[model samples]
Target chain A: MMKQKNVNKRHLRNDILLIIVLLLVAATGAAYLFLFRGFGDVVKVTVDGELYGVYSLSQDRTEDISTGEDGRQLNRLVIREGKAFIQTATCPDGICAAHRAIFRNGESIVCLPHGVVVTVTTAQTQGEPDVVV
Target chain B: MRNKSKTTAFMGLFTALALILAYVEVLLPPLFASLPGIKMGLPNIILVFLLYRRSACSAIVVSLLRIALVTMLFGNVMALLYSLAGGILSLVVMILLRRWNVLSTVGVSVAGGVAHNVGQILMAMLLLETAELGFYLVVLTVAGTLAGVFVGLCGSALIRKIPANFLFLDK
Candidate 1:
């Protein structure tokens, strides 16, 4: 009985350790994502594992991105005031639409049902075409 | 009347319970719409119970059955893919933790939740082919841990109420 009790104590202690380890890892990642993140120069959209297009953040415009086999207009990605947001999407969940405007490097909005991803990237350079206009 | 029938019945009951929970989870508005990975993990309670009482193989079978039934009934094919990935990953983590015996039920469940999120995100990355999307991992992990604690408590409480001889895990 004494050995059993000792073993129980060790298990409980390890459980606490597991929780700490997970939270610690999360905090470290959060620091990188929120604090150390840099402002991105372009918004890159991907559809079905292919690069749909790259839009410069300096330009302001609305783009209708069509998806699925029928090529129906599914998601609308808008870039304005140097920020990008999913203005609209035909997905049932609307998760991308609800996502906040993103402008930092490594920030992105993913629409799972529609297989769309809009990511802010550091690829901005002077020679880039002004695609918005 | 034999041992085989008893195990089958137990697995069936657990599978049904898990499916009901999955359905209810879908009916409820997702808690975190901002990120796709946030889940209450209510069905995990059943999985945890199975892992603790029954063999790991039985637990995995029950978990997969629940996902299949839930997806067939209320979700699409893609949803099934995501659930299968998440369910298997979570089951593996929980079983490993249980085997180590270094953590209690709550710890095992917490690990399960985090693994579930990781697995689903991996499936998304594979489907979408965008590696950059993993940036949201931190947020998803945090939400998963919070949900895990709640589900783990429920599982531990339920385990206490259920009879030890119920699963017939031992010969």
Candidate 2:
């Protein structure tokens, strides 16, 4: 019984150690990513893994992005005052629509159901004509 | 022979309980509006319980059954893909960690939770063909770890209530 109690204590220590290690790893990765990212110059949108369009952040416009069959799916991306956000979406969950405006490099609004990803980027994205309007 | 039947009955009961938990999660709104797939992982309590009490095989069985049923009831084909990836990956990690015997149930569950998120992110990257989604793992790791700790605590509490002898014959 004494040995069993000792083993349990060791197990608890290991558990706490494991949690700390994993959390530290995650925190490190987050810090690295957060530090490297900067203010973006354009908003890039992709639908179902394909490039849909790229709009300059300086442009102020509401783009009706349609996807799926007969353009049945839609996500309205609005870029205003150098910030980009989804104003509305036909996606069931509306997760992307609820996302706050993103202006930092690598920041994104993802719509899983619709397979839409709107990302803010500083680098030039290859694909589709850049819509500067 | 009776013992075999008892195990099967218990498995069924646990599966049902996990399904109920999954349904409950569906009813709850998204925990974080921006993070689409970060679940409370209520079903994980049952997974952890089965892992510690019965056998890894039983835990896998229950996990797969829960995912299959949830997909039919509350999700689509895409959802199935994500769940399948996450569930199997997490279970594999949990089983391996449990074998090491160095950590408690909470630690095993925490590993499982993190693995689940990592697996799902991998699947998302494959499906979307964009590595950018990898960034989500940072946030998901934190969420998964917390969920794992919660589920692990619950599983430990449950195990305390009914020791292995109450339900199973000694191997």
The list of candidate 2 runs beyond 4 A from truth reads: A123-133, B1-4, B33-36, B168-171
Quality of candidate 1 docking, DockQ: 0.70
Worst lDDT 10-window in candidate 2 chain B: B162-171
lDDT of 1 at B129: 93
Native contacts retained by candidate 1:
0.82
Assess candidate 2 and give its TM-score to the true structure: 0.92
Candidate 2 residue-wise lDDT, B16-102, digit = tens: 999999999888988887666678899999989888877898899999999999999878988899999999999999999899898
Q: Relative to the unseen true structure, what is the C-alpha lDDT of residue A58 in candidate 2, on a scale of 0 to 100?
A: 87
Question: Model 1: per-residue lDDT, tens digit, B60-163?
Answer: 89888888888778779888898889888889889988997888888899999999999998999999998886577888788888889899899999888888
Question: Poorest 10 consecutive residues of model 2 chain A by lDDT?
Answer: A124-133
What value does the lDDT take at residue B84 in candidate 1? 88
